[model samples]
Target: MTDQDAGPGPGRTPRLPPRWFVRSAWVVHRGYYRVTGGRRGLWRPQPDKWGTLLLRTTGRRSGQEHAVIVAYFEDGANLVTLAMNGWAAPEPAWWLNLRAEPDAAVVMRDGPRDVRAREAEGEERERHWATFRQLGTDVDGFSVRRPHTAVVVLEPR
Candidate 1:
C-alpha cells in the first residue's frame, strides 16, 4: 500500500519512539533525579534545545504524589508543556492528575516552585503550539495519530 493508505500503520507515527522505550526512558530520567538528590536531570528551554522539568501532581484517587519529567518552555513565569503521552493516544497520567487537581509543582534546574496546571485554550494554545513548531517539534506529524493534544500551562500559585 502507498504511504498515505498506510494510515499510521500500527496507529503510531514511525518517527515517534516506541511506547516501551518511552516508558523506560521516563523511568531512567526519574531515577537520575533521585540518585543525584535532585541536582540534575532538569533544564530550561534554550534557543537550540527543548528544556525539561520534573512535574509533580497529586493523584486523584490515590492521594499520593506522582512525578513525571516533562519538556517545557517558559512564558514569563508560567511553564508550558504538551499533554502528550509520547505521541500515544492517551494523555499522560500526570496530565490527567493535573486535570483532576490543578494544584501542582515543578522542579527546574534553578529550583522547585508551586504552580497550578491548566489547559491552554483558544489563542493561548495556538501561540504555544507555534512555539513548539518553531522549536522543531513534529507537531503536525505526531498529532495526526492522536485525537487531541493539549497545551498545558503551569502558572505560579
Candidate 2:
C-alpha cells in the first residue's frame, strides 16, 4: 500500500506526525525559555530574516494558554504572519485559537506586548502577501497546496 493508503494496522485510522510535531515544538520552546531565563531562546537572533515572534493565545474551548514560535514581519505598528500549517491540510492550532480570542500577547526581541489579531482580506491580504513573497520565502509553493491561507495581522491594543 502507498504511504497515504497505509492505515494503523486494520481498524485504526492513519496517524500523522504534523500535528504531533506541533506539540513537540512547543515543548522544546518552553524548555529553552526556562533554561535561559528569557535572556536567550525567547526570540530569534537579530536581522530576523522573516523575523520571529512568540505568539501566546488562549485556547478557544479549553481556556488554556498556548504558545507558538511563529515567523513574522513587521508592518509599521502591526505584525504579520501566515496561518500556513507547514503547507498541511489543517490550519495551525494557534491560528484557530486566535479566531476564538483575538486578544493575545507576543514576545519579540525587544519585549512582550499585548496585541489583537485579525485576518487580512481582499486588497490588504494581497498587499501583505506580496511583501511575504518578495522576502524570498516559499509562500507560493506551500500556499498552493492548501485551499486557503490566512494572512494574520497583530496590532497592539
Candidate 3:
C-alpha cells in the first residue's frame, strides 16, 4: 500500500493530489515500469487498495498503441475499473480509446490477455458501484464532481 491510502478510514474522502504531482509521478512510474520489464510497478494502486493492471489501447485518433497502468478489481472473471481521469473533469484517454475500439489487451500478474471493454449500465453499474462502496470507497463523492464517471468492465476474449 502507498502513503496516500495509509491514513484514515475509507469513508473519509482523501483530497485529490495536485495535477502536477500526478503527472510528474506518472512520468516516473512509466519510466520505472519500462525499465523493469513488468517486474516492477505492476501492482500499483493510487489509494493502494485495489489491484493494478496494465491496460493497452489503440489511440482513437492516432491509431497508435498506448498503455496505461490502471487500478482495477476483479468481479467474477471480469475486471472492473472507473474511467476517472485522476478525478479530473476530462475523461480518460484510455476509456475514450476503448469506446472507439472495445478490443484491448491487459497485462496482469498472471500475464497478458486480449479482452473486450464495455461500460456497465443500469443495474450492472449500480452493482459495481455498490461493490466499490462496500470496499469503503467514497465513489459517489468523487463521481459527483465530474460530468461522467464510467464504470467499465473488461471481459477476457
Pick the lDDT winner.
Answer: 1
Provide the TM-score for each candidate, comma-separated.
0.90, 0.77, 0.84
Model 1 C-alpha lDDT per residue in residues 36-79, reported as the tens digit of each score: 99888887799856799999899989999999999999899899
Q: lDDT per prediction?
A: 0.87, 0.80, 0.83
Cα lDDT for residue 34, candidate 2: 60
What is the full ranking by lDDT, best candidate first? 1, 3, 2
When superposed on Cα atoms, how far off is each prediction in RMSD? Answer: 3.1, 6.8, 5.4
Off by over 4 Å in 1: 1-14
How would you encode candidate 3's per-residue C-alpha lDDT over 1-157 as one tens digit per residue? 6534443455434566788988777778778888998888776333436777889999999999999988788887899999987777899999999999999999987789899999999999999888777666677766655798999999989
Across 25-93, the per-residue lDDT of candidate 2 in tens digits comes to: 767876787688766665443343687678899999999998877778888899999998765768889
Q: Which stretches of candidate 2 lie over 4 Å from their true place?
A: 1-30, 42-48
Better model by TM-score: candidate 2 vs candidate 3: 3
Residue 145 deviation, candidate 1, in Å? Answer: 1.6
CA displacement after TM-score superposition, residue 80 of candidate 3 (Å): 0.6
Estimate the overall C-alpha local distance difference test score of candidate 3. Answer: 0.83
Off by over 4 Å in 3: 1-14, 44-48
- Report the backbone clash tally of model 2: 1
TM-score rank order: 1, 3, 2
